[model samples]
Target: MILPYPFPLDIQSILNNKNIFRRPPTRFGKMHHTITHPFHTPDQLPMTNQRINHEPVFLLASAPWRESSLWVEVFSRRYGRVALLARSARKRQSELRGVLVPFVPVSASWYGSQELKTLHRAEWIGGWPQPQGRALFSGLYINELMLKLTTREDPIPELYDALEAVMRAVCGENSHTAALRRFEWTLLNRLGFAPDLFHDGNDEAIRAEETYWLTPENAVVPIEEAERFNPRNHGVAVGGNILIQLREGDFTHPESLGQSLKITRLLIDNLLPEGIKSRQVLQQLQQFSFGV
Candidate 1:
């Protein structure tokens, strides 16, 4: 069986002097309108915006819904995390199948008062290139973090901007490591879970030569000063230089990368007790050389 180029255009249509699809119905009234899009607008942007369109979103996850539709999770600037039901999106001629993919910047219009909004329409907002290889996994990891840590409808505009910027940075092979660390810090900070990296638990300025311990209670204690407080558990111990590097936010020192990972891993897992599956996937992928 074969399906033609997809377009959910209405039956009634007119051709201009150029014989183009003039004012073809773009609204999502019914799911039966099946037309191929061998010739469609550039980047698959809807020829018109007859419905409510919000900020561009990144598709986090999508799955089959019924026989012809799809249930998707997306992170947007305005709405944060949202679940959408895209009707007739699985039809061979439907235009949304191509746009509702992970990592793509999509302009999506939806409506509903319930937790799941009905997808009115979608279009690919093409501009930046998608991540490939390990960066791709890193992208998935970010999506998972958004899903697990972020609250639905609790819009964090700054976090959205940070995410969008990191998405672009991760496209570069070597930049993914630095970009992921920066994004992780931003996420933790936005969620109010990040500690004051600049100041230690003792409220003293961290010196580069000292050794510090990160307590389970989210405080940094210098090893030399720990005897004064007689704290029971000092938690993971790290050099003061590593703590300072984390504060720098750039991970300029080669050692900061690994130390940053250890620090963030401990902190994030404490928040997500169920664990991040994407993180596990990344760990497992370490055995294989994708040259990324």
Candidate 2:
């Protein structure tokens, strides 16, 4: 199978789905070709706009609907991710045209007793700067992840919190690397796939002075105690101090950010086997920035 060019590492683990270490879904090739925009409504009505007056939401995506409206995807605290059909949202005078944008928090008012909600009104609840440049790419990547992993109207309270934190971090344009990595780890942990960041292969607490290797099996092994695993599987090497910083979401140390990328890249590749559109866009931006 031809691999996606987003990363050049040995991504055989993604194809085989055997590593089980820091694993993500291995069907992104499927996510790419088939489920380009996977939109769905809640299976049950109780999960819809039952008691919530105006739910805080982030517009994950939007597609043309009926030539004058939009089929929007939104991520909310109790509603997980859901689809809303906004009538006349594309009209020149529509309030939603300016309100339903990704990265901006909105208070959405929608009503329906069925699976899909008909969005009536959306008000800006913004108090943060919008993500721009590289931050925009990061936001797109994150929105794609949410579109892929989250179910309609399912409560993702923790992931919702992480999303808020990421938006603020990226717009802040400081420590974005660590912020992105932390979001990736949080997603994996919520899915019960990520390993413990504070402990190692022997279940011992990671120390600041030690050097460790992150194995493909998601094991954090002390440099001196890494012989049990296959040498080839002993992946990126990182300092225990950096791991500690990563654990605490501290990006003060530049090395910690680089190390975080190496680790998260491996884990994400493990998750999506086919390819990610946002990754391609990001690579293009990087190449353009360097005039390559």
State which candidate has the highest lDDT: 2
lDDT tens per residue, model 1, 116-216 = 66788888878566667777777778877776566555678888888887877776456678878988888877766666667677688888898987753
Residues 1-292 of candidate 2: C-alpha lDDT, one tens digit per residue: 1111123222222323432222234321212221222543334345433534589988877666557877777888877777787888878887766677777688987777666788887888865877767777788888877776665666769989999988888888664777788898777666554556678878899999999987544567788766766766637778899888877777777788788888777765655665677888689878998999
Worst 10 residues of 2 by lDDT: 1-10
Give the residue spans of candidate 2 off by over 4 A.
Answer: 1-37, 40-51, 113-115, 223-234, 288-290
CA lDDT, every model vs. true structure: 0.66, 0.69
TM-scores, all models, native as reference = 0.73, 0.75
Note each model's CA RMSD in angstroms.
15.0, 8.3
Clashing pairs in 1: 5-36, 5-37, 6-36, 6-37, 7-35
